[model samples]
Target: MGNNFKMIAKTLFGFEELLAKELRNLGAGNVKEGVRNVAFEGDLGFMYKANLCLRTAIKIIKPIQSFPVRNENDLYRKIYHMDWFEYLSVDTTFAIDATVKSDNFSHSLYVSQKTKDAIVDKFRDTDGKRPNVDVKHPDLRINVHIHKETCNVSLDSSGSSLHHRGYRISTNIAPINEVLAAGLLLLSGWDGQCDFLDPMCGSGTMLTEAAMIACNIPANINRKGFAFEKWTDFDEALYEKIIAASLKKTREFHHMIIGMDKAPSAIRKAQENIDNANLTDYITLKRANFFKTTKETEGPLHMVFNPPYGERLDRSDLDSDFDVEEFYANIGDTLKQEYPGTNAWFITSNLHALKFVGLRPSRKIKVFNSHLESRLVKYEMYEGSKKAKFQKS
Candidate 1:
């Protein structure tokens, strides 16, 4: 407990609760939820474990300092007064990312510039030479977040986004982000209890994530590196122990995980990615038009996917009056006729097309795919002779 420190895990919108729950399950102390972020207490090893295991977190930040500032000069002075030597040396490379919501600070770039200047000047005064800024790849990445008049300075422990799980060497046109895919699968109540399917699987991201979750595999077990690996205090032995312990917890998954895509290229890419994740034994990828396919498994099925949104992709070949609406309607029809006793969920940016799905969504969650605002909607297909209730368009 003495080694415990506060850390914040940043996530996409509507995933705060999910992240908090994950932190709690991971044995974090004093877990709390915030807007698009979660706060928790853990030691340095736990930090490494969180980065390696968390499915939803985009990045993990360790707060170094917090203060009140009304202007840019104050911000610079407070930042300069901190002992930056603890994190960076004169030979180390660093970068600053700033986010401002204060009435006095309008530009985040300007704030970052001011903070950088303060750090460099402070280092130059003491050590003769100062650390240079390396935006693309830095030894130390500093985050300055200003909310109203309060400023929080933190070190970004995850250098690049956690979505780069290192296993996806291939991708389709609109490959789903791994973090978002994993979160969506969890949100849809995927527990490895039933057969899983991603009918329109683009690059097999959902299938790989589902298999990992089902088997209790560490989310980034295949990842080549993490930002913490570059830290001065990085303990390679401790990290190896954590990795071994996590792998020991892996359980057997009885249900099948399957993926289907009409595009040969998509099927190939999905297969390659699944193999890269070392989950080829647990997942099966097929090149079949979802509309023409029926339930291959005998028991209950769980389906999650992301189809074309008609924004960047061409939906013209879907049908004569092809729009997002018509495409979504086809999805609804295919699910109803072929996949009985299934829970189907998909995400789309085109809300107008959502009405065309015909089935009323049992749950709707707001999330963002990069810059596009999207929704993760769910449809329930009951078993037996009873027909599923759907809103007629």
Candidate 2:
């Protein structure tokens, strides 16, 4: 408890609450939610555990300093004055990623360059040598964020994005981001309680994440490394102990996890990824068109998927006279007629196509896939007419 320090976990839009709840469950203190980010308090071992176990975090940052900056010079001065030796040695390499939302700092790239120069110059003056900047694989990654007149400098504890879970050796054309998939599953209330399905399971990301969550597996168990491993004060034994403890919490999952894709290539890729995650025992993959299939499970089903948005995989391409409107309508029809007692959710950037589905979404969450703003919509299908309320309200 005495070794607690502040950390911020960055996430995609609309996932702040999910990330905050995850932090609290992980035994973090001072948990607070912000826009697309969550702040919390934990010790060094907890930091390692967070990096390894957090499913929705893109990166974890440990803020070292915060101050008001009027201009670029103030930024450089404040950054240069920090105790750089505490985080990095002259022999180590580092990188700076800067974001500017203030009128005083216009170009983020230029600010990063300036900050790098200040740190290198300070180190050179004191130690006669400076750490090299390695943007690709740095020993220490620093983040500088300036909003309005306030500036916060933090050390990025997760060098690469946590989504590079290392298990995905193969991917299809429209492979979903792992963080996005995990967040979507969490948002859909998927706890391995019932059978799970991702009908359009490109690369099998959703299926793998679902299995991991069901079994209480650490999110990054397949990941090779984390930035904290390169820190000056990294404790290898502590990390090993944390891993053992996390693994000990793993539970047995009785429900089935399945994925289906119309394309055989996608099925192969998904299988390879699932095998890589060592989740082959928990998940089953098949090649079938989702629109033509009926629910195979007997109990309530939880379905989450990302269908073609027509921007990339155009349904119109398959049939020149294809009515995308009718296709989405068929999707709604199939879910209503074939899959009863199910909670179906999907994401798409095309809001117009969404209306053609004919079923009112019970929940619409605004999120992004890369740069495109999209909605994660849910449609609940009841077992009988008496329970099947048509309207979202």
Candidate 3:
């Protein structure tokens, strides 16, 4: 790992462990899990691979400098004194994203302004011009993080959140974030071993992510572009090699991946997204209420989905004219009576409605679906003559 440099993969809350494990599995050195982020060491190629493969990572950043700062002036002076010529030029367009958690710096925007001023001032002093600030489509996106008295500066390797997987041109009312979808599948132990189903498959995100995981495909294979592509030292040939190598590792997935939604519009949207992902062959979409359908496959089935919890999806819009509590009860009844020999999992932000399910969850994990605090609960339905016992939550 002599040629390795440290990189940070930012993730959502409760997904740090998954991202760190992914980094280690991808042959990262010195992997460490942080709050909503993971720090690891890898070379340029590995960095690219990490961006392409890390399912739970939101963004990847490369820190360039760390220093102590007493105030805004100290921050500007320290940033100005750095060798900005190595990373940026007058011809490059740049943007600064700041995060401040300190009494010294209360406003993150002000910190970003100071950091930008310092970098531009440095360029102006040496060269005759300075880089222009382009927040939307910057050639280089710099990160400024102030933690109390210390400041850390980094380059954003990922231009946007990894959730923009370049697929899913269509979405339903409440589409789940791609990273959160992938993380939920991983946490459910959905290794593509058996048939998979996302019963309330809104936009087919869970199904798409499940198929990708089953085939070991790179997470960001459909991404538009990374920030590193616009960097000064990007190696095009090495990146091409990395892409080829990652694609070559994809394995065959024989098990069926199924998605069902009652609404015809959602079904159409899901199909469009599945087609966009080029995964129409691996996944099948149907317009049917989950309560009316039974397990189609013979073997043990794996299920993961984000159902309408009455919080996002209005109850009247659903096919059934049942209230939220009644809807949850029906879900519990369906899984218990119709879908036997299946491991079902779903996330719901409606905490009160959870108790109406009546079925105890085999496992429960605390996760966040956007700003709403949610719980991903698992229920294992028994097979054959065996009886499955579960503890009530």
Best prediction by TM-score: 3
- TM per candidate: 0.95, 0.95, 0.97
- Give, for candidate 3, the lowest lDDT window spanning 10 residues: 384-393
Error of 1 at 21 (Å): 0.7
The sequence of per-residue lDDT tens digits that candidate 2 reaches over residues 1-393 is 788999999999988999999999999999999998999999999999999999999999999999999988988898889899898888999999999999888899998999999999999999999999999999999999999999999999998899999999998766789999999999999998899988889889999999999999999999999998999999999999999999999999998898999889889988999999999999999999888999899888999998754565545445677676787887788888788889999988878888888888889998898777988999988887834677422
Q: Which ten residues in a row have the lowest lDDT in candidate 2?
A: 308-317
Which candidate has the highest lDDT of all? 3
Q: What is the C-alpha lDDT of each candidate?
A: 0.90, 0.90, 0.91
Task: State the lDDT of candidate 3 residue by residue for 1-393, as single tens digits.
Answer: 588899999999999999989998999999999999999999999989999999999999999999999899999999999998998889999999999999998999999999999999999888978999999999999999999999999999999998999888998787899999999999999998899999999789999999999999999899889999999999999999999999999999989999999889989998898898889899998899998988889989999989865566765656665677788988898888788889999999988999988888878899998898999999989975543464334
**Per-structure clash totals for the candidates:** 0, 0, 0
Q: lDDT: which is higher, 1 or 3?
A: 3
State residue 318's C-alpha deviation in candidate 2, in Å. Answer: 6.7
Q: Please give the ranking of all candidate structures by lDDT, highest first, separated by commas.
A: 3, 2, 1
Candidate 1 TM-score, C-alpha based: 0.95
